[model samples]
Target: MSVYTEVGRDQLIAFLADYAVGELVHYQGISDGIENTNYFVTTDKGEFVLTLFEHHDFGELAYFLDVMTFFFEHGIPSAHPAADRQGRYLKKLCGRPAALVMRLDGRGVANVASLAQCEAIGDILGQMHIAGQQFQSRRHSQRGPEWRQETAQRLLPMMEADQAALLKNELAFQKGYADLDLPWGVTHSDLFRDNALFDGEELRGIIDFYYACDEYLLYDLAVAVNDWCVDESGTLALRHYQALMSGYLQHRQLTDAEQANWNLVLRAAALRFWLSRLQDKLFPREGEITQIKNPDAFLKILQQHRHQPFSVDELQ
Candidate 1:
């Protein structure tokens, strides 16, 4: 498991004292994610997920917790942050910012998602965007254009000529749309397949809101499509794309500006993942259980989006 900062039983018990979650019965490290140290925690009161922020500070962590709470209250099937006895969702455990959230009751679908699954994901994602309109605080995307440009420069030194060229070209391409006045709202910036949980075909829950921020709403949809609707060859599947778009439009219709820039936003989504993966692979952090995803997968996906931009009617 990815137990980067191990928590002793004594320390855990002390931490639980701040909350009314009863006694800590057992806990196990979750190895799936790379951003934070997570544990599937069981208590006498109920089951919850314990997280210790490895990189983010307490102030930054508060925004994510607030967003999660907002979504849960607004009927979204997202994990709700469990506030402590003091009514604070944010806490300190092992000298790191920590939180306890209700454990979702489902497993992540690691394999390719079915069309039904894609539709469900799209539907819920659109609902999330709609519900997020009421959120008060604004957090800019951490992986926005500024980060992309800086990261590209840092990774170019370690990349080959072709890889360097692709990164630079895409970065420049994204710069042109920096001020395109797209629909903005709280977006789950990293909504991949595993980030959602399902039971059979039913989407039980969506987890990991640490990457949630203020960004283009269509960009969020593009992020979901690039992962949930793409085939093994990194090409967008027509059937899956249609299903996703159909499901999304059922709840929220795209603005005319969003429609006009759909192709560009899709490319931006691909570039975001591509740049992140390359950065992670090239300059990995020291963790107990690190899984560096294949950067080339996103590279291919970006290329495909660049070459085969889709139209609105194609999705319908």
Candidate 2:
């Protein structure tokens, strides 16, 4: 849960009326994200998701919204940015920038337990990567080496002796694979199971574009592998990985060189999230629900990847 400053019912109603979308009959704060404030808004027209701009750049967010709208038109299951009375994608509310979007009808898969679930995730990710190739706008972000370096620096103070040593060694290893050639495109940046929703057994929609930026396409897949292929005990779930990779390869094929670099990508992904969580832990942002994801989870992943290597055979 995150901090959700309540917008008065009358105010929201007034907004809907001004926008001419409908009367905002009811509204409530959504408490599942760490980046921005979300609200479940229902108007006379229909139900929608209202997001308030917080920490992220508004211009970048506007670009992201456009991209998402593009995908939505092309049959990608996503929230479409709604327009106000002036036909604007963005609206000003209470001195904050806000936008309305269609609410996705599904729940998050917090614990993806089965092989079919893994395959579903893989298929969706593959589709996203393929569709993302046409998105030409560029917004830069750190993913591989630079991200690890930046995060390590931020977490250096909070980490204990052993964790610091591990981070150093991991950095060195990541640098070795930094020169590998990989396909670049717009990446979701954070596509954990929670970012996606399943309408019953089918993957319904993908949400949360705050971290969407231009980066190595495989890094996004790598993030998914690290997130979806590990068990609770920090062990590699080989069968699940196999299902996911199979589903992914069905759309976008990986080359031998790309396959070789997968290990590095996985390690980089692990360290990236680990360092981010550590930063959050050290500098807790002022919020109602500070969502400091478990950095130790990815730390355990780095340790696990060190000894028990992941291979294409493992994926199969």
Q: Return the top candidate by lDDT.
A: 1
lDDT of 2: 0.77
Alpha-carbon local distance difference test for all models: 0.87, 0.77
Best by TM-score: 1
Residue pairs clashing in model 2 are none
Candidate 2 per-residue lDDT, tens place, 64-118, comes to: 7887887787677877888776788887666567788888888788785568878
lDDT of 1 by residue, 1-316 (tens): 2457888899999999989989999998888866788889999989999999888998899899889989999999999999888899988888888899999988888988988999999999989988888999999889888887888888889999988887787777788767988889999988898889999889999999999999999899999999988888899888999988888989899888888898889888888888887887778788666667887888888899888877776667
Span of ten consecutive residues with least summed lDDT in model 2: 1-10
Instruction: List candidate 1 stretches off by more than 4 Å.
Output: none
RMSD of each: 1.3, 2.0
- Total clashes, candidate 2? 0
